[model samples]
Target: MIVAQAKPIEEILEMIDKYDKILLVGCKGCVAVCAAGGEKEVQFLASAIRTARKTQGREIEIREVTLERQCDPEYVEQIRGFAGDYQAILSIACGVGVQFMAEHYREIPALPGLNTSFMGGALEQGVWSERCQGCGNCVLHLTGGICPITRCSKSLLNGPCGGSSNGKCEVDPEVDCGWQLIIERLKALGEFESRFMEIVPIKDWSTSRDGGPRKIVREDMRQ
Candidate 1:
């Protein structure tokens, strides 16, 4: 999932300082799971904003709403009526959700209320670690399910780099070497030599961020 954290209250306030009418939009997906943006979060943030505005003697209208998702165009369109009435949107979803809202509504400004962190899973409540970089490719199968792209400091697909020392990453003493984890996992699974296998090079990164505005053209879906 796209991991993220809610933006600081002070920064959020500064972003919408000029707007009198603001809509605090949340998502019921990734951000919701992370407790950064959801129905409850939306309500809480709305209350905070209103209270702050009142204390500042500022005239403002704040409303909160949570959608099933902001990434899907269909669900995003549902907010057109609600969002149109507002001068700006404070999306509490991930960065993707904020961009989608901004793109869907050209007239109204969309401000991100959360900072997208990474593709990761929660180890516990309120604790999430990066496990994937979404590099437009997948190589976890060969790496024993541990993603070197995120866990490895150097993102080396083959094996550990010179920076690995005594099974720990040289960059951080607290971090276990990503390749070490991969080797251990592979050994446990009886695929100890998976690391030595030759794999074809990952290609076509032009379809990713390095290229300008990567797009998918599904003829059937195109209207």
Candidate 2:
């Protein structure tokens, strides 16, 4: 899932200070699961903004709405009826959601309320860890299930890199060495001797962000 963190309230206030009325949008998708931009978060933010503006002797009007997903055009279009009534739109979804809202409503400014962190999953309650870079090339079949691209601090393809020590990454002692995890996993699966000896070729940079923003066209999924 895409992980995101809320922006500072001070920064958010500054962004909407000029607007007396604004639409506060939230996503019930990845941001909701992460607790950054959901229905509860939207209500909390609205109350906080109202209190802050009231304390400053100013009045602000805000309409809060939570969409099933801000990334989908269908969900975004649901707000078309009353979106123009607001001076600006504050979206607490991922960066993609903010951009989608902006693109859909060209007249009103669509502002981001959260900083898109990374594509990752929850490690534990209130703790999320990045696990993938979406490189467009998956190597989990070649390596063990562990991802060297994201788990490895240096993104090394084949390495414990001379820096790993005591099964921990030298870059940060707290992190487990990605290659170490892979080797152990392969050993458990009885494929270490065979798979580890097979050297992985240099990855194609064209499949990753180095090439450009990417898109997929699926004729079967098209309407």
Candidate 3:
């Protein structure tokens, strides 16, 4: 899932300080699962903003709303009728959602309330680790399901980099070496010798952000 962290209250206050009326929009999608932006978080933020403004002897109006997904046009359109009433929208969604909101509501100021982190998953309680770089080319079939692109500090395709020792990464003693994990996984699967002998080719990053922003037009999915 897309991981994100909420921006500081001070930063958020500065962004919407000029507006007397603001809309606090939250997403019940990725941000919700990560405890960054959700219905509960929106309410918390709204109350905090109200309190802060009150303490300054300035009155402000804020409307809190949580959408099924701020990234989807259908859900975003649900706020169309009342959105114009606010001077600005504070979107507590991922960067994609904030951008989508800005695009859909060109006249209104769409501000991001969270810092989009990365594509990752929860490793344990309250701990999330990045596992994919979305490099456009997938090599997990040969790498024993470990993503060297993200797991490896240097994003090496085929390497232990002569720095790894005792299965730990040289860059960080606590982190495991990506190549070491891949080799161990392959060995357990009885394909170590065969796969290791086959050299991995240089990655063509054109499929990734190297070229430009990407889009997929699926004829089957689109009506």
lDDT agreement with native, every candidate: 0.87, 0.95, 0.92
Q: What is the lDDT of residue 66 in candidate 3?
A: 98
Better of 1 and 2 by lDDT: 2
User: For candidate 3, what is the TM-score?
Assistant: 0.95
Judged by whole-model lDDT over C-alpha atoms, candidate 1 comes out at 0.87
lDDT of 1 by residue, 1-223 (tens): 8888878999999999999999889999998998999999999999889899999999789887899999999999988777889999999999889999999999999999999998899999779888876676677888789887789898777778888889999999988899899888989998976555665375556645666666777999878
Model 3 lDDT tens row, 1-223: 9999999999999999899999999999989998899999999999999999999999899999999999899999999999999999999999999998999989999999999999999988778888888888888998899998888888888667989999999999999999999999999999899888787788899988887998889999997
TM-score of each: 0.89, 0.97, 0.95
- Candidate 3 CA-lDDT value: 0.92
Task: Look at candidate 3 and give me any clashing residue pairs.
Answer: none
Better of 2 and 3 by TM-score: 2
lDDT tens readout by residue for model 2, 1-223: 9999999999999999999999999999999999999999999999999999999999999999999999999999999999999999999999999999999999999999999999999989999999989999998986778899998988888667899899999988898999999999999998898888777788898989998999899999999
> lDDT value for candidate 2?
0.95
| TM-score top scorer | 2
Give one clash count per candidate, in the order shown.
0, 0, 0
